[model samples]
Target: MVRQFVSSGSTFETQMGYSRAVVAGDWVFVSGTTGFDYSTMTISDDIGEQTRQAFANIAAALEQAGSRLDEVVRVTYVLPDGGLFEQCWPAMRDAFASARPAAMMIEAGLASPEMKIEIEVTALKGSAA
Candidate 1:
């Protein structure tokens, strides 16, 4: 199949010149997704809630790219505070309960202070890989 893009309808996708997810053949590469609730263009201050929202955002993009969370083959988590990883486990567990995609975490600065977490993932478009 030809390459395709999935848009989250976020203004950043235009301003930043990036898609929420890109589908190239059978693989879908999702961009780093933050906790911003696109509907309201706002984010939660709590790390746990932000983690959940980040996953929700990623899931939405994956769905648009003809994939689902359970099909995710790899996951990358970026956190501004390493200490908050524990706080994010429940949400992560809920999302990856079955698939348990290959995962990694890194401590890094994000775009803004309120943004605590960002998630990026790769999934097979037609099947779980």
Candidate 2:
């Protein structure tokens, strides 16, 4: 199948020249997503809250790509502080309990200072075996 691009309607997408997610055949790759609420254009300082928002953003992108978090095959989280990881774990566990995708965490900087976490995911168009 031809590749399909998905958008989250965030200005950063247009500015950065990237799609929120792309679908190539049965695979869906969601771009790295920050916690800023595109609808409100705001970000939270709380790491846990940021983590939740990141997952929600990822879920939306997955849905647009004809997939869902439950179909995710991989997830990667980028955080500025390694110590903040535990705060983000429950959010991950809640979304990933069933999907249980391969996951990795990295310490990294983000686009903005208020942004606490960014998440990226890969999913299959169908359920994982």
Candidate 2 lDDT over 1-129, as tens digits, reads 798999998777899899999999999999998888777878888998888888899999988888999999998999888899999989988989899998899999988788888899999877755
TM-score of each: 0.95, 0.95
- Candidate 2 residue pairs in clash (backbone atoms < 3 Å): none
Across residues 63-121, which tens digit of lDDT does each residue of candidate 1 receive? 88878998988999999899989999999999888778889999999998999999999
Whole-model lDDT values for every prediction: 0.90, 0.89
Best by lDDT: 1
- The 10-residue segment with the lowest total lDDT in model 2: 120-129
The local lDDT score (0 to 100) that residue 2 gets in candidate 2 is: 94
The C-alpha stretches of model 1 lying farther than 4 A from their native spots are none
